[model samples]
Target: MKIGRNEKCWCNSGKKFKHCHYGRESEQAITKGELIGQSKNIRSRKCCYVPKALQHECDRRIVNAHTVSKSGSLIEIADSTNHVYGLKINLANIFKNKGKLVPEKIGVNQASTFKGFCSKHDKQLFSCIEDHPFNATEEQCLALMFRSVAKELYAKEGSLLSSEVIKSGDKGKQLADQLSIQKFAADNQLGIKAALRELSDFKDQLDGQLLGNFTNNLSHLIFESSRSMPVAVSSIVSPVSDFNGTIIQDLGDLNVVAEQIVFNSFSSDGKGYVVFSWLTKSAIILGFVNTLIAIDKAGIFGALIRLFFGLAENSFISPEWWDGLPDAQKKKIESLIMSGVNPFKFDPKGLLIDDGVNFSGWNIDNIRKINF
Candidate 1:
């Protein structure tokens, strides 16, 4: 029979279930190499990303949420089913090692996810955002995706801080300030919630008109072997910050808010640049720039920015230059441009390596291989 956390332990230890075997089941599951499914912790708290109007009802039934959707497939630099790339960076070790890189065998999984949202909001609100990336093309689609991810990241940070506040032994002004920060984060998330819901409705209207074209564009971008594509996409197994130490410091100055997604668009010397970055434990960065910039040059810049400034700024071949070209011709140019960049040149310490039988010329796949 099942037992409640507050009830006596089934083992008859004369202690509460929580203090006795409440969490042991999870521990055993982990030891046995099984996924724990989801968190068993439930509390009487409002859905963190729910709209203000629904706040009252949200508190009545809350569920553990996944920060990143589990459904989306991880974007791979090179697609080979038989070959798996192993990342030897341990994120938890970075903090314990006093900000030093400690390499360990951390298998990279495309399906990695974290828990933090209510079931109702997850299905109704965040699912659209999660699904957008696969077909994202226009700026509006990207904005909606970024905003939704940012809200989830900030909410997770606030939840962590709140837990710390509760666990702290001290009770004083400092504790009050911590609580205030947590509340501020929660408030910020609500604004994102309202914006995302509005965007979702707007996106629904555009879907009928834009989705077909967007899907066509995406297919051309992903499947065509041409080098002229104006964008680059790459995924890393560890936290983005662990790969770049300076980001931890640079991000601190952007704002007091936790884990902000940085999106920037600018033009320099007759070239356009677009950068979308989500600063999470695992990050997928999408970059679009003028095609004039060499892929290797752009890769170098991407690595340095992540290393020194936690950003990427590079010139791109102008879209106006190719505006009238046939769609077929344009796709070829885009493919060539994408093929030129070495996406994996930035790991200064050589932490990322490819172990699969087929090593596609993807820059990330060629970086120094570590045999941990």
Candidate 2:
């Protein structure tokens, strides 16, 4: 079980053992401040959306683009202080919350924002969804899906880039702890790499459509809420099960690139919209969508709340509504939300079913399906 000093590190860091983990236990542990700084540095490196044709059109300044529009969606749910509750996923915040992820009050301007696009392209590309009303048009749906996927792609790349900082926690730890941490990091990196490949492909397709000024091979389902919901979210999920507890895709299969679908929810024009968008002719996603439609109109909101907390992390909650929930209910929802993003958690079965918890009282007014 002994590794040669010149051999690759047991942690799979692609460095020799002597240069990577050898004598790591004797080193000083990475301070919390260091980890925070490293994370900030990673985030500070901006990424822009510049296709081959638009490279010359990109702006010099990279802006923090909102996946969920700030002017239209987030402002509708902001409290008196213009803030909303967002799940903080940093190591310091997680440790502060006793090793659990919790929703922290964040300014609406900062919530759901990512430095994923330049100012010029951000304005030009997302004008339909960002500047105007949402009527479930093909352009608007494509914009919605584009922003969701782009945000997710940026996030996954960040997580992958932060692996070294994460592995630094193994410093000054016992060999067993170091092994556990490194193994988890290695496994997580693999997952992120797989996700990045799929996201890059999807983004390329979206970029092609944007460049061609056409919408093709896109499908969407839009559910109109009779009233505004207290939450706004933009995320991508590879669904494993449906509302009926039937498995539609096996997310555990390492060889398969799991089917992904974009789920976005926001309030616009005095009503709420829950949108699901995906590529064309995906039987797996189609089945998943069918189960969602099969849910009774009365219970659709509850089903969506469960599914959102179970699978998505880019969800924001109105401070007023979240504060009104009972402590036990909030705890239950937090656990459900963490189950989706926590690397150590593995229970993905029956994530969309009713769990005897209802977080929304809004009713579905209409359901619209679009194929193009």
- Leading candidate by lDDT: 2
What overall lDDT goes with each candidate model?
Answer: 0.32, 0.84
Instruction: Give the per-residue lDDT of model 1 (tens digit) for 154-227.
Output: 43444444433332212223435434544555564554454344344433333422334333111111222212
The C-alpha local distance difference test score for the whole of candidate 2 amounts to 0.84
lDDT of 2 at 85: 91
Cα lDDT of model 2 by residue, 248-269, tens digit: 7766677887888898999988
* Root-mean-square deviation per candidate: 16.9, 2.3
Model 2, 209: alpha-carbon shift in Å? 1.8
C-alpha lDDT (0 to 100) for residue 46 of candidate 1: 39
Cα error, residue 165 of model 2, in Å, equals 1.6
The reply for model 1, stretches above 4 Å from the true place, is 1-47, 53-64, 75-115, 129-133, 137-372
Error (Å) of candidate 2 at residue 136 is: 1.5
TM-score of 1: 0.33
